[model samples]
Every structure is written in C-alpha cells, then in structure tokens.
Target: MATKVTEMNEVKSSGIPGLDTLLSGGFSQGRVILVLGEPGTGKTIFISQFLYGGTTQGNENSMFIGMNEPKSRFMIEMSGVGMDFDALERNGKFSYVDATEVRRIPEQAKVGRIHVGGRELGLVNLIDMMQEGMAKVTPKRIAVDSISDLVFRFPTIEERRPVILDIIESLQTTGATCLLTSEVLSTGEERTVQPEEYLAEGVILLRRLPRKGMRSVQVLKMRGQKVDTTPRPYTITDKGIEVYASEEIY
Candidate 1:
C-alpha cells in the first residue's frame, strides 16, 4: 500500500524498514521498478514482500505474473517466509498468473496446474493475458517475477529489445506500481548493463557479500527521487529480506 502522493515526489512505503530508508521513503508511485540480482540474492523475496505488504497491510490489491515458476512452487517458497498467497487470493486481494509452461502447452489446454489458451503464448499473447488479468483484479501493485524468460525467449537482441520494452510500456499503462525482476548475468565486480536497468524508472541491485552467505543491496537509480546509492548489507531472515541500511557492509 502507498500514501496518496499530493506532490510529484511523494512516495509509498516498501514495507521493509531499512529498504524504505534507503529509498528515502519508498518507490515512486505507479512507476516501474527493476529489481536486479543474481539467482540466490533474494530478488523474489523483495518483490514478494512488496506485494504481500501492500495487500495485507495497506489494503491494496496486488498481482503476481510469474513466467519461470509454477504457482504451487512459488506459493510454497513464499510460505517459508510467512506469506500466505493462497489466503490472500481467497480473500480477493491477490491474483497469480503463471506463464511457465506457455512454450510447451497447446492452446486452450490445461497442463498440470497452469491453463494456457487463446493464441500460442508468445509475447503478444502474454501481454493480452496480463491485460485480461488486470481488468479482473485491477491491482494497485503488480510484479512480473522475472522478465528474463520473456526477454531471452527470442533469438536476437533486436527481437528481445522490443518485447521487453513493450511489456514495460504495457505495465506503465495499468496505473499500478510495477516491479520487474531481472537476473544479473555476471556476479563479480564487472557486469554488463541490461536494457531493463535503464528502461525502468527505478533500479534496485542486489549482490552476494564476499563474507560467506550475506548479501548487499543498493539503489542504482530512481528517476524522480533523491536516492541513496550506497551499498548496504542485507540478509534473508525468516520473515523476509531485511536490509541494514545504516550498517557498513564489512
């Protein structure tokens, strides 16, 4: 949930204490935020917290469109962190759209738990499905688990670029604050810039700390907000991703 922004810079709380402080409030209202990290850096946990917090605490409607994971597995994983997506859905505050099996499933067919229908499940079809889902739930906060699956579905960069841009553009039109997760190809000091990093209005990067299993989070950029770009230590606690904004990474 977010406060009504009377001014252009007014923000909403990310619901994560240290993260909100690092964001200087929270993410800009209705803007697309890119959460970038390597596989185990808790990007999913971050977005899950955002949506779950909004629906459960802020009285907001939320949706999750997952492209790489099944709804069952996703729910089980989130349950470990104390999020009951099933309950939220039962209460009409949450919705999940699973697109993991789009490539293999035939049109208008049910593959296990996912239902794929109407067209061949390409980029265009996925966007259409998203729009349909939006019309039903009309969420205020939305998350696309990882746009990387859709990004890499095509063979070339020329083809991939427009697909991603189109998806982002479509999300922007929904009037919902959106969080799109993306995987970092390289985890070391040097990393290539991905298109989503520059395209989204805000970017949050997570990195694995060199000291064993810890993690670090940084706000790379936020278009209309004064952001703290400092790298802060964070950890995946039982509740969820917790950031130590004022603490040094050592």
Candidate 2:
C-alpha cells in the first residue's frame, strides 16, 4: 500500500468497520472501487458484504453481476455465510445478473425473462445486457462479483482495454456506487496490478500471506477519498470479511 491523499464530503459505509476507517469513512459516493486479490483472498466475500450491507443496513437496492459462477450456486454459498439474497430479492431490494451464464446459454438466459428491459440481447455484446439490467434495476449500488475474468476474456491489453473502459463507463451512467473485483497474486513487497486497477476510481487490494496464514487488506488508490495506506489485516468468518483497520499482522 502507498499513501496518497484526497478529500471528500459524503461517503457510504463499506459495512466492514476497519475498512471504512482506512477509506476515511467508506467509499466516496458513486465511486468505482476495485477489489483486487488472488483466489480465496475473500474478494467475493468482500463484495457480498458491500451489497448485503447496502440492502440491509443502508436500505438501498443493489445489483450483483457475477461472471465466474452460477447465480443459484453463488446465492446458496453466500447463504451459508449469512447473506440471504433470496430474501432480499423477494422483497425487490436486490437483483442479480449472471454474466457467465448469458454467454453459455443465451437462449436460456433471456433478457425478458430476467426483466432486463424486456428485450433481446446477444452474448457477444455483454455491455448491452448489463445496461438493460442496470436500467431495469436502477439500483443505488452495483457490484460485478469478479470482472477479473475479463483479464482473461480479452487476453491482450489491446483487446481488453476498450471492453474494460466500456463497462466502467456504462456503470458510471447508472449513478450507483460500484464495487468491482479482480484476481491478483501478491509476493513479499510487490504485486501484479490488473488492468481494472488503472480504470477504477479506487483499488482495494487483498492478499493472503502463506507463511503467516493470514489475509490483509489495503487501499491502493482512492481517487476522491483520503486513503490510509497502512496494511490492515482481515479475516473471512461466517459473516464475511472483517477488516481490522489499524491492526498489524505477522
């Protein structure tokens, strides 16, 4: 983590207490935040908490666009951790768009069936499908469970950059604070930076130290909010990722 400062007036609680403190009181309003980490570093759990907190505590509607997993399986797993998406969706406060499934079963994942603008959308153009879903939900908060798949989807930066920018731009238009997730491996003092880190307004990097058997969270960059660069230790329990903002870990 590096120290870089900025100022902001209004913020949204991230639902993780220590993290909110590191973020100077949570994500800036409508800011695009990237949660970067390797597999099992709790990226999905972190975003799940953000959306769950928004619907349950903030009373705001939110959307989860999942690329790497099935919606049914994802929800059931999250339910084990205490986030009841089915209950929230039943009340019309939460909506989900399975990004990968649309690519797999375009006929089965019908736009009208999902109520995404009540029209047809082709798999080749995912942004259109995302747009229709956003417009239909008009959520106050939006999350893409792990757009890290895009890093592989496009393969090369040239092929990936446009698509990445396009999705971020589209999300910006929805006027919802967005949380994006990606996968990255961390070494001793250096880590690989994904393309999404460059495009996002803020980047929250999570890492697991194998020798210590502990996970840590850091604010790599926050465009409009003051950032506390200290590496904060965090853990994934039954509730979700609980960040200890000011604590140090071995």
Candidate 3:
C-alpha cells in the first residue's frame, strides 16, 4: 500500500545508503529535487534506488518516467543493480511510464499500475499522463530519469526555465517527493549551473573526481533542511548507489 500523505516540512528518506545522514534525515517531503550529473555518473541508478527503496522499505508507491532510455533496457540494466522492478510491479507498488517518445498521448487512455505504454508524449501530455497515474495509484514518490530531452527542446535557458517550472509544479500537486535527473552539458573543466538547479527545491550533484574512476556526490541545496553539502565519495555497487557520507572526497 502507498504511504500516507506527509506534511510539507516532514523529511522523506532518499533511499540511498548514507544519503539520509547528509540531509539531516532526507529530502523535504513532497518537494522536487534535481539530480544533476553527466553521462554514466550513476544518475539513473541513484533515482532507481530511491524508487525501489521507497516501495520495498518505506511502503510508498513509486513511479518512474523515462525520457531517454527504453523500458526494456532500463529494466534489464536496473536488474543488474538489484532493483527487481518486476517483483515490485507484481506487488502493485511500482509503475513505469515509457515516455521515450515526446509526441502526444491520449488523455482518456487508461494508466496502468505496472507499465503504462505510450508511443509518444509532449510536455502537456506528459503532465497529463503523470496526473492520470497519480490519480490511479497515488504514489508517494515519483522520479523522471532525465529531463534533458524535454529541456533541450527549448532553444535557450530562458525558454527552458518556465518549462521546468511547469514540470515541477505538476509533480508537487500530488504531495509526492519528486526527483528529476538532469544532464550537465559542460565539456570544459568549469561547470555551468543549470536553470533547473535554481528551480528545484533541492539539488544533488554527482561527478567523477580528478582521480580515475572515482565518483562523488554533493548536496548543493535542500530547502527546509540543513544539508551537509559536502563532497562525499560514492560508488555504484551491485546492489545500488552507496554514499560514504561520513567520509570526505579528497
């Protein structure tokens, strides 16, 4: 069964090991969080863990909307990381929306609790699909694997900012803790802050350190909570992402 509705100020565990310690508990309940990182920086795995953990441990229904990856590949890859979405779906605690296509989805279409198949989706249709799914299952945790596709459709940041806000607003309407993954587009050493970083209620950045193959996670900002904001070492284990919150990334 899905968890009960929480107050706006309550903390909701992020579902990743050691991550809660950094957030003084977890993300602010029902707020949207931006998970910023480059390709292969474990962004997908991070959100998968959050969703899986919520269903298995927190008794919360979870939804995953994929904008970049196919549902088959995503399920297979996530299986390698020990997230048995198949089982979760069987138990009626998980749902997956295949939104790889950004065309348009029918409003009257039924939303599935296991996997809602869609040929294409637009920004408006995407929000409609999410609302239909939320109305169907009332999931307490929702995640979008990556919003880069949706954001890049706009020519500039100014155009993208309002779109991102609309997405966030749709997510918050259900009082579910939302996590949206965004890609960092910088090729140079220095980083360019994304507009979503300013729009989200929280921002968590994952990056590859100077040392070869070493990864780190940092919480840049989390509204209504005092986050550590430290650059902590992390790893993508067979089970899932693990953050060494007690240790520093030196």
Instruction: lDDT for model 1, please.
Output: 0.83
Model 2, span 145-199: residue lDDT tens:
7765545555577766776787788788777888988777454575566677799
Give the lDDT of residue 111 in candidate 3: 49
Write down the TM-score of every candidate.
Answer: 0.88, 0.84, 0.88
Instruction: Quote the positional error of residue 92 for candidate 2 in Å.
Output: 0.3
What CA RMSD would you report for each candidate? 5.0, 6.2, 6.5
| Cα TM-score of candidate 2 | 0.84
Q: Evaluate residue 103 in candidate 2 and report its C-alpha lDDT on the 0 to 100 scale.
A: 42
lDDT of candidate 1 at residue 238, scale 0 to 100: 77
Alpha-carbon deviation at 63 in model 2, angstroms: 0.4
Regions of model 2 farther than 4 Å from truth: 1-9, 102-124, 185-188
Better lDDT candidate (1, 2):
1
lDDT of 3 by residue, 183-211 (tens): 98872457778899999999998998879
